[model samples]
Target: YFFRDPERRPPDLPGAVVAPADGKIIDLSLVEAGPVHDSAARKVSIFMSPFNVHVNRIPVEGVVKALRYSPGKFAAAFQSKASLDNERQYVDFAGPYGRVGCVQIAGWLARRIVCHLRVGQAVHPGERYGMIRFGSRLDLYLPPECDIRVKLNDRVRAGETIVGVLHETK
Candidate 1:
């Protein structure tokens, strides 16, 4: 069940950003100049249980600028510190709205993260980019111009739910 790939249809509204993973929203916060991103961003975190689909998708259409993987400790997917302390992979993209960062974090049961993205590869929203074995977490660092759609504790489906709508910055 965890390996099944479901068909998803992304919203066509301009600037609409789709959820990258199927999970429950665990966090929504503002952050600045940390790790993969150097500008102000709003992080939308989702915690995936072992029963949920492990596949991950692109949140927006963009060109991958970099991919960074770090070996670290296993932690609970819902913990705030897990984003930093857990083994993870970060994908940085140069999007139409600017920079976007997606971090795939390993939880207690997840040890491997499979990523299909390469530096400079152009990706579209809803496209499968990777997967994490068992349970894990995904964090999307979005620009401040986003109008977020989901609230904390809300459940979202990868490549389908519109997590937010981004607006162009002046």
Candidate 2:
């Protein structure tokens, strides 16, 4: 099947950022935010196994400001350095309170990354927007003001688990 139905709906929490893909939370760290985000941000990387769902969902309600695809080497998604060298797609969303970024990284076992949304498109929290065939990795980038809720080695379900929460800026 190309997509699997979600067993549960996304939670209705204020400023909640949901997981984009169902997988194990492989890494969590503070990384230098790319051009799509500010100076520094919290990075949550998820490693999707073949048994996990491949479909991806929107992390928050927002407009897609930018979508970029970077082609690179196919490396193991669990490796920290793989984020920089792996083939990936970067999606930036402008939420009501803040901006967030999601990167779909191609792992050594994943051959394709499919994204359905485009620039300037409106999306909602937990909305299914894309998927990666087979196994892959998804990285959620949160602004400095947001708080991450998931930890390394945590198992997260796409669209159902709250990965982080955005805090309003003064």
Candidate achieving the largest TM-score? 1
| RMSD to native, candidate 1 | 1.2
Q: Which 10 consecutive positions of candidate 2 have the poorest summed lDDT? A: 1-10
- lDDT string, candidate 1, 1-170, tens digits: 76888888888977778999999999999987645567778999999999888899999887999999999999888899999899999999777777778999999889889999999999899999999988699999888778999999999999999999887545
Give the Cα lDDT of each candidate. 0.89, 0.88
TM-score of each: 0.95, 0.94
Which portions of model 1 show Cα errors greater than 4 Å? none
User: Which runs in model 2 stand beyond 4 Å of their true positions?
Assistant: 1-3
Report RMSD (Å) for each prediction in the order shown.
1.2, 1.5
User: Lowest-lDDT window of 10 residues in candidate 1?
Assistant: 32-41
Go through the candidates in order and give the clash count of each. 0, 0
- The lDDT leader among the candidates is 1
